[model samples]
Target: MNPQSADAGDRTTGRYKQKREAILNAAARLFDENGIKGTMLSEVAQQVGLSTNSITYYFKKKEDLVFECLMHTTSTISAIAAESAAGATPEERVTRFVTGRWKKLAEAAEGQYPAMMSFRDVGELDASYTKTIFSAYGDMFRRVRGLLAQGPVTSDNRMSLTIRTHLLLTSTQWTRTWLSNFSVTDYGRLAAYMCDVLINGLLAPGKPWAPTALDEKVAAIKLPEPSNRNFIAAAISLLNEVGYNGASIDRISARLSVTKGSFYHHIPSKDDLFAECVSRTLAVVEGMQAAAIAGEGSGGDKLAALARSLVGFHFSPRGPLLRMTAWTELSNLEQFYGQVQPMRQLTQTVVDFLATGMMDGSVRPTHQAIAAWMVVGAINGSATLDKWVPGSEKTDAVELYLKPFFCGICSE
Candidate 1:
């Protein structure tokens, strides 16, 4: 071939590679912001200045692009977990993992890396794509769990490791939700603070985790609006299983063995449906908090009661509490319901509990807000108890699940 022809071919290849990375970057960001079910490939194409048809040159279909994007995200996290494995101690490993991950997040915030993903819709993909995604996630889960393994591999430690691994992962992931509140420079400090909460826990020494029963019991939740409570429950079930977009009108109606007309009759729109699900979640959380606060107990009592009740509620008929990933759609839900930021209120309520505990000598003097985020993260992750653990029915969530966060994950 002539030199000029070869040189032109090389230039074309380089440009193609650049655009492909650009597409992946843009798609990842869109997926994170709008969710996998919510983002359109054409939107990704538009973000990268390519025509939708032009995108097909790189990815023949939207799922191809989504699979690649998810794979790219999985690889990024696996690499971090691998590196974090080098720490000599479990706490050090935990600290390094959180710090390194956030540094990448700092970079992502500064456009240095693809936006870190929320694995909420890993199940939303088709069987062919999800098999690979779930496998990658499983490996990553093991790697993080390895960070917590101290010695002999007993079922007890296995339980703790499994529980703590999810706790650590979800809490760190939850950081992306609230961490934006801080500057990129503050991420490292915040990561350290998070590690402290995970390792040392929130309980002040000598303060037993004696969560008293609620003074005034919360009535079973009837949501969206009172008149359409059953319909809202079905909708919440679908939202928890699928997602906002995946919870189609068809599925909601079918879950209740009703017609689409019924869904529309009971629920006005999908946006309203999401608002109702979120509203129900906040109501449950706030109900527990209010009951806890009204009782005469240390901060520890209020928090323990709140955490245990919320987690157990998932197993209850009204359960599953709107999944933490639902918070990503906060802005849209807020618009639908007007300016009541239920998520912010949720975090602040935990902060109030932690602060109260610290004052009353029931909880340690830690970074109250960050510690609250850990609680939020751990509890959010634990809500998947039925799915993640075998015989989640038999599992004492307060002991096996909640203990890691309430008492230190590493404590004896």
Candidate 2:
């Protein structure tokens, strides 16, 4: 081999590699800023100071290049998740895990992938492109699930912990992706706070499980109580599928396959029914928390049980009522505060746990107001994200994401 020819060949290879990287970066920025369908190969090539023909030489199809760009972004996120996992303490790992992904989203917000929010939203429409993105976050998902399933280091497990973990991650990320109406700082802070609540609940003292109690009560009493009180269950379905204003007595009656007269017997009027639905849903949540508080367990166990109950119940079919409650609380500010005190009380239990934990040495010093709101937001985000992710097997996708944030704020 001639030494001069070898050096020239090496230089040629290096230049080609650099150009390819440049093209991929440009494509990602474009995709994150514009929808994948909105971006063009010519635009990508032009952005990178390359001719269309030159880009074609590297990537035959525009989509092939788009897929690569998505993959590149995913890879960056994967590296961050890995780094977070490798960090010294759970708290440091969580902060890095969260902040690192936030930085990635901020960077991409100016591009095409960010525009789409997440690959799962459009993966079915373009499988190859989404696959590349999914590959990047798969590891993070596994790590998150593993953490939640093990029973928190500070809490107890009352439900399917693995399922809850998956729900938490799915919902939190989806919220950040879809609800851009909220600021990024608020979303991130909210996610971190919710995770802390779950962690505190798991490790705190008490029997935090709910389904078990329902089972025991049913067994002992032998009474067939309504899984839901009266027509409240049917009313919730209508409210979720349609907005609160759209759901009327006629609609509820129709959904129940009963006459309006039959529905009237359950409640006084449409207004009463809507209020009842919200109250009943909150009652279930509060009931779970109450059970956790009263049960025999450590503080950590009580907290985890309450956390699991909150997340699990929220994902249940009736869970949409929680959103309805929030909407009502915000929209009818005059009436919501008075009518929704019981629901807010469930939230107070969470706030109380954090305040109690901080003072007792279970949780680090943190503001109850800030921490409580963060958990609430993350739970909301988790619900929003699950709707957009494609082929997501998770029913309770927010659990894992919430757990780490929960763990991050704990004493240990």
On lDDT, the leading prediction is 1
lDDT (Cα, tens digit) per residue for candidate 1, span 1-412: 1111123454468677677778878887777777777888789989989898888777777777778777877788788889988988888888888888888888877865667667776667788888888888788888888888887558766765776677777778777667757998998888788878888888888777644545224233333445777777777767766677777888888888988886788788877777777677777776776766676677777777777788877666666677767546444554644424555566787888888889988898899888887788777776655555557556666677787788887664
Can you write out model 2's per-residue Cα lDDT over 1-412, one digit (the tens) per residue?
1112123444468676676666776776565445455567888888988888777777777767766565555566557666766655544555566566666665445442332133422442355455545655565555654433333433244234433444445434444423454565565665565445444433334322333443332122221235445477666655544345446677778878889887766677876766666666566655666676667543444455565555555555535434422233123455656666665665577677666666666555555765555555455544333443433225333344445445533232
Score candidate 2 by TM-score against the native: 0.45
Off by over 4 Å in 1: 1-17, 152-156, 213-230, 257-275, 330-335, 339-343, 388-390
Q: Model 1: how far is 254 from its true place, Å?
A: 3.6
- Worst window of 10 by summed lDDT in candidate 2: 215-224
lDDT of 2 at 315: 59
Root-mean-square deviation of every model: 4.7, 11.9
Assess each prediction's global lDDT (C-alpha) against the native. Answer: 0.74, 0.52
